[model samples]
Target: MASSDLTRKPTIRDVAAVAGLSHGTVSRVINGGHWVSPEARAAVEEAIRTTGYTTNHAARSLATGRSGSLAFLLTESQQLLFSDPTFALLLRGATAALAERAMTLVLLIADSPGEQANVERYVRAGHVDGVLLVSSHASDSLLASLVAAQVPTVCSGIPRAGDTPVPSVSIDEVGSARMMTRYLMDRGHRRIALITGPNDTPGGRFRLVGFREELGDRFDPGLVEQGPYERDSGNAAMTRLLERAPDIDAVFAASDVMAVGAIDALRR
Candidate 1:
Protein backbone atom coordinates (compact mmCIF):
# COMPACT_ATOMS: atom_id res chain seq x y z
CA MET A 1 0.00 0.00 0.00
CA ALA A 2 1.09 3.55 -0.72
CA SER A 3 2.06 5.89 2.17
CA SER A 4 -0.86 8.16 1.16
CA ASP A 5 -3.34 5.32 1.93
CA LEU A 6 -1.68 4.49 5.29
CA THR A 7 -3.75 7.11 7.16
CA ARG A 8 -7.07 5.44 6.22
CA LYS A 9 -8.38 1.91 6.61
CA PRO A 10 -8.21 -0.16 3.39
CA THR A 11 -11.60 -0.93 1.85
CA ILE A 12 -12.90 -3.48 -0.67
CA ARG A 13 -12.44 -0.83 -3.37
CA ASP A 14 -8.73 -0.75 -2.61
CA VAL A 15 -8.54 -4.52 -2.90
CA ALA A 16 -10.46 -4.43 -6.19
CA ALA A 17 -8.18 -1.72 -7.53
CA VAL A 18 -5.10 -3.69 -6.56
CA ALA A 19 -6.57 -6.91 -8.04
CA GLY A 20 -7.38 -5.13 -11.35
CA LEU A 21 -11.01 -6.27 -11.07
CA SER A 22 -14.40 -4.63 -10.51
CA HIS A 23 -15.54 -4.11 -6.90
CA GLY A 24 -18.43 -6.57 -7.52
CA THR A 25 -15.99 -9.33 -8.51
CA VAL A 26 -13.94 -8.66 -5.37
CA SER A 27 -17.17 -8.79 -3.30
CA ARG A 28 -18.19 -12.15 -4.77
CA VAL A 29 -14.76 -13.59 -4.05
CA ILE A 30 -14.87 -12.28 -0.48
CA ASN A 31 -18.35 -13.76 0.04
CA GLY A 32 -17.08 -17.20 -1.08
CA GLY A 33 -18.81 -17.39 -4.44
CA HIS A 34 -18.28 -20.54 -6.53
CA TRP A 35 -18.90 -18.55 -9.75
CA VAL A 36 -15.44 -16.96 -9.64
CA SER A 37 -12.66 -18.68 -11.58
CA PRO A 38 -9.60 -19.87 -9.69
CA GLU A 39 -7.41 -17.13 -11.14
CA ALA A 40 -9.87 -14.36 -10.21
CA ARG A 41 -10.28 -15.70 -6.65
CA ALA A 42 -6.51 -15.95 -6.27
CA ALA A 43 -6.00 -12.37 -7.44
CA VAL A 44 -8.60 -10.94 -5.03
CA GLU A 45 -7.23 -12.91 -2.07
CA GLU A 46 -3.70 -11.79 -2.89
CA ALA A 47 -4.84 -8.17 -3.18
CA ILE A 48 -6.62 -8.40 0.15
CA ARG A 49 -3.46 -9.63 1.86
CA THR A 50 -1.24 -7.11 0.08
CA THR A 51 -3.46 -4.11 0.89
CA GLY A 52 -4.25 -5.39 4.42
CA TYR A 53 -8.00 -4.87 3.77
CA THR A 54 -10.53 -5.89 6.38
CA THR A 55 -14.26 -6.06 5.89
CA ASN A 56 -16.39 -3.20 7.16
CA HIS A 57 -18.87 -5.52 8.84
CA ALA A 58 -21.23 -2.79 9.92
CA ALA A 59 -21.70 -1.52 6.38
CA ARG A 60 -22.08 -5.03 5.00
CA SER A 61 -24.59 -5.91 7.73
CA LEU A 62 -26.71 -2.88 6.93
CA ALA A 63 -26.70 -3.71 3.23
CA THR A 64 -27.58 -7.37 3.79
CA GLY A 65 -30.12 -6.66 6.56
CA ARG A 66 -28.23 -9.04 8.85
CA SER A 67 -26.31 -7.86 11.89
CA GLY A 68 -23.58 -10.42 11.22
CA SER A 69 -23.62 -11.36 14.89
CA LEU A 70 -24.91 -14.11 17.18
CA ALA A 71 -25.69 -13.91 20.86
CA PHE A 72 -24.00 -16.14 23.44
CA LEU A 73 -26.97 -16.10 25.78
CA LEU A 74 -26.30 -17.44 29.26
CA THR A 75 -29.40 -17.71 31.40
CA GLU A 76 -27.31 -17.71 34.56
CA SER A 77 -26.01 -15.21 37.05
CA GLN A 78 -22.97 -13.11 36.12
CA GLN A 79 -21.16 -14.65 39.09
CA LEU A 80 -21.69 -18.14 37.73
CA LEU A 81 -20.82 -17.04 34.18
CA PHE A 82 -17.41 -15.69 35.22
CA SER A 83 -16.62 -18.19 37.97
CA ASP A 84 -17.22 -21.23 35.77
CA PRO A 85 -14.30 -22.05 33.47
CA THR A 86 -16.56 -24.08 31.19
CA PHE A 87 -18.40 -20.93 30.15
CA ALA A 88 -15.06 -19.34 29.28
CA LEU A 89 -14.13 -22.29 27.10
CA LEU A 90 -17.53 -22.27 25.43
CA LEU A 91 -17.25 -18.55 24.76
CA ARG A 92 -13.77 -18.94 23.28
CA GLY A 93 -14.86 -21.73 20.95
CA ALA A 94 -17.92 -19.79 19.79
CA THR A 95 -15.84 -16.68 19.17
CA ALA A 96 -13.33 -18.60 17.06
CA ALA A 97 -16.04 -20.23 14.95
CA LEU A 98 -17.80 -16.94 14.30
CA ALA A 99 -14.53 -15.20 13.46
CA GLU A 100 -14.00 -17.56 10.54
CA ARG A 101 -17.27 -16.39 8.97
CA ALA A 102 -16.53 -12.70 9.65
CA MET A 103 -19.28 -12.65 12.25
CA THR A 104 -19.28 -11.32 15.81
CA LEU A 105 -20.51 -12.84 19.08
CA VAL A 106 -22.52 -10.85 21.63
CA LEU A 107 -22.71 -12.04 25.24
CA LEU A 108 -25.92 -11.62 27.21
CA ILE A 109 -26.42 -12.93 30.77
CA ALA A 110 -30.03 -13.09 31.95
CA ASP A 111 -30.55 -14.70 35.32
CA SER A 112 -33.43 -12.34 36.16
CA PRO A 113 -36.70 -11.48 34.45
CA GLY A 114 -35.63 -7.90 33.73
CA GLU A 115 -32.41 -9.06 32.16
CA GLN A 116 -34.31 -11.57 30.08
CA ALA A 117 -36.60 -8.83 28.85
CA ASN A 118 -33.59 -6.76 27.81
CA VAL A 119 -32.10 -9.68 25.89
CA GLU A 120 -35.43 -10.37 24.23
CA ARG A 121 -35.67 -6.78 23.07
CA TYR A 122 -32.14 -6.77 21.74
CA VAL A 123 -32.75 -9.97 19.78
CA ARG A 124 -36.12 -8.79 18.46
CA ALA A 125 -34.50 -5.63 17.15
CA GLY A 126 -32.49 -7.74 14.66
CA HIS A 127 -29.23 -6.98 16.40
CA VAL A 128 -28.26 -10.62 16.10
CA ASP A 129 -28.84 -13.25 13.41
CA GLY A 130 -29.31 -15.98 16.04
CA VAL A 131 -28.57 -16.92 19.63
CA LEU A 132 -26.16 -19.54 20.91
CA LEU A 133 -27.77 -20.39 24.23
CA VAL A 134 -24.86 -21.33 26.50
CA SER A 135 -26.93 -22.19 29.56
CA SER A 136 -30.61 -22.29 30.41
CA HIS A 137 -33.01 -23.45 33.13
CA ALA A 138 -36.24 -25.36 32.52
CA SER A 139 -38.34 -22.51 33.91
CA ASP A 140 -36.52 -19.68 32.10
CA SER A 141 -39.02 -17.67 30.04
CA LEU A 142 -36.24 -16.49 27.73
CA LEU A 143 -36.50 -19.68 25.71
CA ALA A 144 -40.19 -19.10 25.12
CA SER A 145 -39.54 -15.49 24.25
CA LEU A 146 -36.86 -16.46 21.77
CA VAL A 147 -39.31 -18.89 20.25
CA ALA A 148 -42.05 -16.27 20.04
CA ALA A 149 -39.67 -13.90 18.29
CA GLN A 150 -38.96 -16.63 15.73
CA VAL A 151 -35.23 -16.38 16.33
CA PRO A 152 -32.98 -19.33 15.46
CA THR A 153 -31.10 -20.73 18.44
CA VAL A 154 -28.66 -23.54 19.20
CA CYS A 155 -28.35 -24.65 22.81
CA SER A 156 -25.15 -25.87 24.45
CA GLY A 157 -27.00 -28.59 26.36
CA ILE A 158 -30.26 -30.45 26.05
CA PRO A 159 -33.01 -28.07 27.11
CA ARG A 160 -36.36 -29.29 28.38
CA ALA A 161 -38.24 -30.56 25.35
CA GLY A 162 -40.67 -27.83 24.40
CA ASP A 163 -42.84 -26.80 21.42
CA THR A 164 -40.13 -24.41 20.24
CA PRO A 165 -37.97 -26.37 17.84
CA VAL A 166 -34.63 -24.98 19.08
CA PRO A 167 -31.82 -27.43 18.28
CA SER A 168 -29.34 -28.45 21.00
CA VAL A 169 -26.11 -30.42 21.58
CA SER A 170 -25.20 -32.23 24.77
CA ILE A 171 -23.12 -35.00 26.24
CA ASP A 172 -24.49 -38.19 27.79
CA GLU A 173 -24.96 -36.62 31.20
CA VAL A 174 -26.73 -39.61 32.73
CA GLY A 175 -24.23 -42.18 31.53
CA SER A 176 -21.33 -39.95 32.55
CA ALA A 177 -22.61 -39.69 36.12
CA ARG A 178 -23.35 -43.42 36.27
CA MET A 179 -19.83 -44.25 35.12
CA MET A 180 -18.22 -42.00 37.72
CA THR A 181 -20.37 -43.39 40.53
CA ARG A 182 -19.46 -46.93 39.47
CA TYR A 183 -15.79 -45.98 39.21
CA LEU A 184 -15.77 -44.86 42.84
CA MET A 185 -17.52 -48.09 43.84
CA ASP A 186 -14.97 -50.14 41.91
CA ARG A 187 -12.26 -48.45 43.98
CA GLY A 188 -13.94 -49.95 47.08
CA HIS A 189 -15.42 -46.64 48.20
CA ARG A 190 -18.68 -47.73 49.81
CA ARG A 191 -19.67 -44.47 51.52
CA ILE A 192 -19.61 -42.30 48.40
CA ALA A 193 -21.33 -38.90 48.39
CA LEU A 194 -22.92 -37.09 45.42
CA ILE A 195 -22.96 -33.36 44.72
CA THR A 196 -25.36 -32.48 41.94
CA GLY A 197 -26.48 -29.50 39.88
CA PRO A 198 -29.86 -27.81 40.46
CA ASN A 199 -33.07 -29.65 39.55
CA ASP A 200 -34.08 -27.02 36.97
CA THR A 201 -31.13 -27.82 34.67
CA PRO A 202 -30.77 -30.93 32.46
CA GLY A 203 -27.33 -31.73 33.84
CA GLY A 204 -28.56 -31.27 37.41
CA ARG A 205 -31.60 -33.49 36.90
CA PHE A 206 -30.30 -36.28 34.61
CA ARG A 207 -26.88 -36.78 36.22
CA LEU A 208 -28.50 -37.36 39.61
CA VAL A 209 -30.82 -39.89 38.02
CA GLY A 210 -27.81 -41.80 36.67
CA PHE A 211 -25.97 -41.61 39.96
CA ARG A 212 -29.03 -42.91 41.79
CA GLU A 213 -29.69 -45.69 39.27
CA GLU A 214 -26.05 -46.77 39.25
CA LEU A 215 -25.93 -47.14 43.03
CA GLY A 216 -29.37 -48.85 43.11
CA ASP A 217 -29.86 -50.47 46.52
CA ARG A 218 -26.57 -49.03 47.74
CA PHE A 219 -27.60 -45.42 47.24
CA ASP A 220 -27.85 -43.29 50.40
CA PRO A 221 -30.07 -40.22 50.33
CA GLY A 222 -28.28 -38.83 53.36
CA LEU A 223 -25.07 -38.48 51.38
CA VAL A 224 -26.59 -36.57 48.43
CA GLU A 225 -26.33 -32.76 48.30
CA GLN A 226 -27.65 -30.42 45.61
CA GLY A 227 -25.43 -27.62 44.30
CA PRO A 228 -25.81 -24.60 41.92
CA TYR A 229 -22.83 -25.53 39.68
CA GLU A 230 -20.43 -23.14 41.39
CA ARG A 231 -17.44 -23.61 43.68
CA ASP A 232 -19.12 -22.11 46.75
CA SER A 233 -22.18 -24.25 46.30
CA GLY A 234 -19.97 -27.28 45.76
CA ASN A 235 -17.95 -26.49 48.88
CA ALA A 236 -21.10 -26.05 50.98
CA ALA A 237 -22.63 -29.22 49.56
CA MET A 238 -19.49 -31.23 50.26
CA THR A 239 -19.33 -29.89 53.81
CA ARG A 240 -22.96 -30.86 54.35
CA LEU A 241 -22.42 -34.32 52.89
CA LEU A 242 -19.51 -34.88 55.28
CA GLU A 243 -21.57 -33.55 58.20
CA ARG A 244 -24.40 -35.96 57.41
CA ALA A 245 -22.10 -38.89 56.73
CA PRO A 246 -18.85 -38.47 58.61
CA ASP A 247 -17.45 -41.64 57.05
CA ILE A 248 -17.97 -40.50 53.43
CA ASP A 249 -15.17 -42.03 51.32
CA ALA A 250 -15.67 -40.39 47.89
CA VAL A 251 -17.66 -37.63 46.13
CA PHE A 252 -18.89 -37.20 42.56
CA ALA A 253 -19.57 -33.55 41.78
CA ALA A 254 -21.56 -32.77 38.63
CA SER A 255 -19.39 -29.77 37.69
CA ASP A 256 -15.60 -29.38 37.59
CA VAL A 257 -15.75 -26.21 39.69
CA MET A 258 -17.75 -28.11 42.30
CA ALA A 259 -15.18 -30.92 42.29
CA VAL A 260 -12.50 -28.36 43.12
CA GLY A 261 -14.65 -27.17 46.00
CA ALA A 262 -15.16 -30.75 47.19
CA ILE A 263 -11.37 -31.15 47.22
CA ASP A 264 -11.11 -27.92 49.23
CA ALA A 265 -13.64 -29.33 51.69
CA LEU A 266 -11.48 -32.45 52.02
CA ARG A 267 -8.42 -30.24 52.67
CA ARG A 268 -10.31 -28.34 55.34
Candidate 2:
Protein backbone atom coordinates (compact mmCIF):
# COMPACT_ATOMS: atom_id res chain seq x y z
CA MET A 1 0.00 0.00 0.00
CA ALA A 2 1.15 3.53 -0.74
CA SER A 3 2.39 5.70 2.17
CA SER A 4 -0.33 8.27 1.56
CA ASP A 5 -3.03 5.56 1.79
CA LEU A 6 -1.55 4.08 4.94
CA THR A 7 -1.52 7.54 6.57
CA ARG A 8 -5.31 7.90 6.20
CA LYS A 9 -7.32 8.06 9.41
CA PRO A 10 -8.15 4.54 10.64
CA THR A 11 -11.86 3.59 10.62
CA ILE A 12 -13.90 0.87 12.30
CA ARG A 13 -13.63 -1.28 9.14
CA ASP A 14 -9.83 -1.09 9.29
CA VAL A 15 -9.83 -2.16 12.95
CA ALA A 16 -12.18 -5.04 12.22
CA ALA A 17 -10.06 -6.22 9.31
CA VAL A 18 -6.88 -6.09 11.42
CA ALA A 19 -8.61 -7.97 14.28
CA GLY A 20 -9.89 -10.69 11.92
CA LEU A 21 -13.50 -9.95 12.91
CA SER A 22 -16.62 -8.51 11.27
CA HIS A 23 -17.47 -4.82 11.55
CA GLY A 24 -20.45 -5.78 13.74
CA THR A 25 -18.12 -7.32 16.30
CA VAL A 26 -15.91 -4.22 16.26
CA SER A 27 -18.98 -1.98 16.68
CA ARG A 28 -20.24 -4.10 19.58
CA VAL A 29 -16.82 -3.85 21.29
CA ILE A 30 -16.63 -0.12 20.81
CA ASN A 31 -20.17 0.43 22.08
CA GLY A 32 -19.72 -1.60 25.29
CA GLY A 33 -18.37 -5.12 24.56
CA HIS A 34 -21.71 -6.45 25.74
CA TRP A 35 -22.13 -9.54 23.56
CA VAL A 36 -18.54 -9.90 22.39
CA SER A 37 -16.37 -12.73 23.71
CA PRO A 38 -13.33 -11.91 25.87
CA GLU A 39 -10.94 -13.05 23.14
CA ALA A 40 -12.71 -10.90 20.55
CA ARG A 41 -12.72 -7.91 22.85
CA ALA A 42 -8.98 -8.23 23.48
CA ALA A 43 -8.25 -8.62 19.79
CA VAL A 44 -10.38 -5.58 18.97
CA GLU A 45 -8.66 -3.47 21.64
CA GLU A 46 -5.24 -4.50 20.33
CA ALA A 47 -6.26 -3.75 16.76
CA ILE A 48 -7.69 -0.35 17.81
CA ARG A 49 -4.41 0.49 19.55
CA THR A 50 -2.32 -0.56 16.56
CA THR A 51 -4.61 1.10 13.96
CA GLY A 52 -5.28 4.25 16.04
CA TYR A 53 -9.00 4.07 15.33
CA THR A 54 -11.19 6.76 16.88
CA THR A 55 -14.97 6.52 16.95
CA ASN A 56 -16.90 9.25 15.15
CA HIS A 57 -19.25 10.34 17.89
CA ALA A 58 -21.40 12.47 15.59
CA ALA A 59 -22.01 9.60 13.25
CA ARG A 60 -22.80 7.26 16.13
CA SER A 61 -25.24 9.73 17.62
CA LEU A 62 -27.01 10.17 14.32
CA ALA A 63 -27.42 6.44 13.86
CA THR A 64 -28.55 5.80 17.44
CA GLY A 65 -31.00 8.70 17.77
CA ARG A 66 -29.03 10.01 20.74
CA SER A 67 -27.38 13.43 20.84
CA GLY A 68 -24.70 12.27 23.28
CA SER A 69 -24.93 15.71 24.87
CA LEU A 70 -26.33 17.19 28.08
CA ALA A 71 -27.39 20.71 29.02
CA PHE A 72 -26.31 22.37 32.28
CA LEU A 73 -28.94 25.05 32.52
CA LEU A 74 -28.66 27.90 35.04
CA THR A 75 -31.67 30.11 35.68
CA GLU A 76 -29.93 33.06 37.23
CA SER A 77 -28.86 36.53 36.18
CA GLN A 78 -25.52 36.79 34.40
CA GLN A 79 -24.01 38.84 37.20
CA LEU A 80 -24.93 36.25 39.83
CA LEU A 81 -23.83 33.39 37.58
CA PHE A 82 -20.43 34.98 36.99
CA SER A 83 -19.88 36.04 40.61
CA ASP A 84 -20.89 32.80 42.34
CA PRO A 85 -18.32 30.04 42.89
CA THR A 86 -21.13 27.53 43.38
CA PHE A 87 -22.12 27.82 39.72
CA ALA A 88 -18.52 27.28 38.69
CA LEU A 89 -18.26 24.15 40.79
CA LEU A 90 -21.53 22.85 39.42
CA LEU A 91 -20.29 23.34 35.83
CA ARG A 92 -17.01 21.61 36.56
CA GLY A 93 -18.68 18.62 38.19
CA ALA A 94 -21.26 18.26 35.42
CA THR A 95 -18.59 18.50 32.72
CA ALA A 96 -16.45 15.81 34.35
CA ALA A 97 -19.44 13.48 34.79
CA LEU A 98 -20.56 13.92 31.16
CA ALA A 99 -17.04 13.41 29.82
CA GLU A 100 -16.80 10.09 31.65
CA ARG A 101 -19.81 8.87 29.67
CA ALA A 102 -18.41 10.09 26.32
CA MET A 103 -20.94 12.91 26.16
CA THR A 104 -20.69 16.69 25.79
CA LEU A 105 -22.06 19.34 28.16
CA VAL A 106 -23.74 22.51 26.88
CA LEU A 107 -24.11 25.48 29.22
CA LEU A 108 -27.28 27.58 29.05
CA ILE A 109 -27.83 30.70 31.13
CA ALA A 110 -31.44 31.82 31.17
CA ASP A 111 -31.97 34.76 33.49
CA SER A 112 -34.80 36.57 31.73
CA PRO A 113 -38.14 35.37 30.53
CA GLY A 114 -37.10 35.79 26.89
CA GLU A 115 -33.93 33.85 27.43
CA GLN A 116 -35.86 31.17 29.23
CA ALA A 117 -38.26 30.86 26.32
CA ASN A 118 -35.41 30.49 23.84
CA VAL A 119 -33.70 27.89 26.01
CA GLU A 120 -36.94 25.97 26.32
CA ARG A 121 -37.28 25.87 22.54
CA TYR A 122 -33.69 24.78 21.99
CA VAL A 123 -33.92 22.03 24.57
CA ARG A 124 -37.26 20.81 23.28
CA ALA A 125 -35.82 20.48 19.80
CA GLY A 126 -34.12 17.18 20.69
CA HIS A 127 -30.66 18.74 20.73
CA VAL A 128 -29.57 17.14 24.01
CA ASP A 129 -30.37 13.81 25.62
CA GLY A 130 -30.99 15.36 29.05
CA VAL A 131 -30.55 18.47 31.18
CA LEU A 132 -28.78 19.18 34.50
CA LEU A 133 -30.68 22.13 35.92
CA VAL A 134 -28.88 24.36 38.45
CA SER A 135 -29.61 27.46 40.52
CA SER A 136 -33.31 27.22 39.80
CA HIS A 137 -35.68 29.62 41.56
CA ALA A 138 -39.08 28.58 42.89
CA SER A 139 -40.89 30.92 40.49
CA ASP A 140 -38.78 30.14 37.43
CA SER A 141 -40.99 29.16 34.48
CA LEU A 142 -38.35 27.05 32.76
CA LEU A 143 -38.87 24.07 35.04
CA ALA A 144 -42.56 23.79 34.22
CA SER A 145 -41.89 24.07 30.48
CA LEU A 146 -39.21 21.39 30.62
CA VAL A 147 -41.51 19.09 32.54
CA ALA A 148 -44.37 19.70 30.12
CA ALA A 149 -42.10 18.88 27.20
CA GLN A 150 -41.03 15.66 28.93
CA VAL A 151 -37.31 16.24 28.46
CA PRO A 152 -35.27 14.13 30.80
CA THR A 153 -34.00 16.43 33.58
CA VAL A 154 -32.08 16.20 36.85
CA CYS A 155 -31.92 19.24 39.10
CA SER A 156 -29.00 20.18 41.35
CA GLY A 157 -31.49 21.04 44.11
CA ILE A 158 -35.00 19.83 44.75
CA PRO A 159 -37.42 21.55 42.39
CA ARG A 160 -40.29 23.58 43.91
CA ALA A 161 -42.14 22.11 46.92
CA GLY A 162 -45.16 20.84 44.93
CA ASP A 163 -44.28 21.48 41.32
CA THR A 164 -43.34 18.95 38.66
CA PRO A 165 -41.41 16.04 40.14
CA VAL A 166 -37.92 16.27 38.64
CA PRO A 167 -35.24 13.90 39.91
CA SER A 168 -32.36 15.65 41.72
CA VAL A 169 -29.14 15.30 43.73
CA SER A 170 -28.65 17.65 46.70
CA ILE A 171 -27.61 17.74 50.31
CA ASP A 172 -30.23 18.14 53.04
CA GLU A 173 -30.21 21.95 53.23
CA VAL A 174 -32.43 22.06 56.33
CA GLY A 175 -30.36 19.48 58.18
CA SER A 176 -27.08 21.17 57.38
CA ALA A 177 -28.44 24.53 58.46
CA ARG A 178 -29.71 23.03 61.69
CA MET A 179 -26.35 21.47 62.37
CA MET A 180 -24.54 24.78 61.85
CA THR A 181 -27.03 26.63 64.09
CA ARG A 182 -26.69 24.00 66.80
CA TYR A 183 -22.91 24.27 66.68
CA LEU A 184 -23.12 28.06 67.11
CA MET A 185 -25.49 27.67 70.06
CA ASP A 186 -23.17 25.09 71.62
CA ARG A 187 -20.30 27.57 71.30
CA GLY A 188 -22.22 30.07 73.50
CA HIS A 189 -23.35 32.33 70.71
CA ARG A 190 -26.80 33.35 71.90
CA ARG A 191 -27.49 36.28 69.62
CA ILE A 192 -26.78 34.33 66.42
CA ALA A 193 -27.98 36.23 63.37
CA LEU A 194 -28.75 34.92 59.86
CA ILE A 195 -28.17 36.44 56.39
CA THR A 196 -30.53 34.43 54.27
CA GLY A 197 -30.73 34.02 50.51
CA PRO A 198 -33.84 35.03 48.55
CA ASN A 199 -36.92 33.32 49.97
CA ASP A 200 -37.93 32.29 46.42
CA THR A 201 -35.22 29.65 46.36
CA PRO A 202 -35.46 26.24 48.00
CA GLY A 203 -32.06 26.51 49.68
CA GLY A 204 -32.98 29.92 51.06
CA ARG A 205 -36.31 28.76 52.51
CA PHE A 206 -35.00 25.46 53.86
CA ARG A 207 -32.00 27.05 55.53
CA LEU A 208 -34.25 29.56 57.33
CA VAL A 209 -36.58 26.77 58.40
CA GLY A 210 -33.68 24.74 59.76
CA PHE A 211 -32.20 27.72 61.56
CA ARG A 212 -35.50 28.56 63.23
CA GLU A 213 -36.14 24.92 64.07
CA GLU A 214 -32.73 24.52 65.69
CA LEU A 215 -32.89 27.79 67.63
CA GLY A 216 -36.35 26.91 69.06
CA ASP A 217 -37.09 29.56 71.70
CA ARG A 218 -33.80 31.28 70.93
CA PHE A 219 -34.85 32.04 67.35
CA ASP A 220 -35.24 35.81 67.38
CA PRO A 221 -37.24 37.23 64.49
CA GLY A 222 -35.54 40.53 65.18
CA LEU A 223 -32.12 39.06 64.23
CA VAL A 224 -33.36 37.56 60.95
CA GLU A 225 -32.46 39.36 57.69
CA GLN A 226 -33.35 38.38 54.14
CA GLY A 227 -31.58 39.33 50.93
CA PRO A 228 -30.52 38.09 47.54
CA TYR A 229 -27.72 35.52 47.48
CA GLU A 230 -25.22 38.14 46.39
CA ARG A 231 -22.23 39.73 48.03
CA ASP A 232 -23.76 43.20 48.21
CA SER A 233 -27.01 41.78 49.54
CA GLY A 234 -25.11 39.88 52.21
CA ASN A 235 -23.20 42.98 53.17
CA ALA A 236 -26.39 44.98 53.42
CA ALA A 237 -28.14 42.29 55.44
CA MET A 238 -25.18 41.96 57.79
CA THR A 239 -25.17 45.71 58.37
CA ARG A 240 -28.88 45.65 59.11
CA LEU A 241 -28.54 42.74 61.54
CA LEU A 242 -25.76 44.54 63.40
CA GLU A 243 -27.90 47.66 63.66
CA ARG A 244 -30.92 45.66 64.83
CA ALA A 245 -28.96 43.66 67.43
CA PRO A 246 -25.60 45.11 68.40
CA ASP A 247 -25.09 42.20 70.80
CA ILE A 248 -25.14 39.60 68.03
CA ASP A 249 -22.11 37.32 68.41
CA ALA A 250 -22.25 35.18 65.27
CA VAL A 251 -23.78 35.29 61.79
CA PHE A 252 -24.65 32.51 59.38
CA ALA A 253 -24.51 33.59 55.76
CA ALA A 254 -26.28 31.26 53.38
CA SER A 255 -23.51 31.05 50.75
CA ASP A 256 -19.74 31.45 50.61
CA VAL A 257 -19.96 34.73 48.69
CA MET A 258 -22.51 35.95 51.22
CA ALA A 259 -20.16 34.96 54.03
CA VAL A 260 -17.37 37.01 52.48
CA GLY A 261 -19.67 39.99 52.25
CA ALA A 262 -20.79 39.49 55.82
CA ILE A 263 -17.16 39.49 56.96
CA ASP A 264 -16.55 42.68 55.00
CA ALA A 265 -19.57 44.28 56.62
CA LEU A 266 -18.24 43.34 60.08
CA ARG A 267 -14.87 44.92 59.25
CA ARG A 268 -16.63 48.15 58.40
How would you encode candidate 2's per-residue C-alpha lDDT over 170-256 as one tens digit per residue?
A: 889999999999999999889999888888888899999999999998898998888887899888988888887899999988898
Give me the runs in candidate 1 sitting further than 4 Å from their true place. 1-11, 50-52
Q: Give the per-residue lDDT of model 1 (tens digit) for 1-268.
A: 6889889999999999999999999999887667898999999999999999987777877777788889999988999877889999999999999999978899998888999999899999999999998778888888878888889988899877664767899999999999999999999999888899999889999998999999999998888898689898888998888777898878888899999898898899
Residue 32, candidate 1: how far off, in angstroms?
Answer: 2.7
Note the residue pairs that clash in candidate 1: none
In model 1, what lDDT does residue 221 have?
Answer: 85
Sliding window of 10 residues with minimal summed lDDT for model 2:
1-10
C-alpha RMSD for every candidate: 2.2, 2.0
**Residue 265 lDDT (model 1):** 88
Candidate 2 ranges beyond 4 A from true positions: 1-4
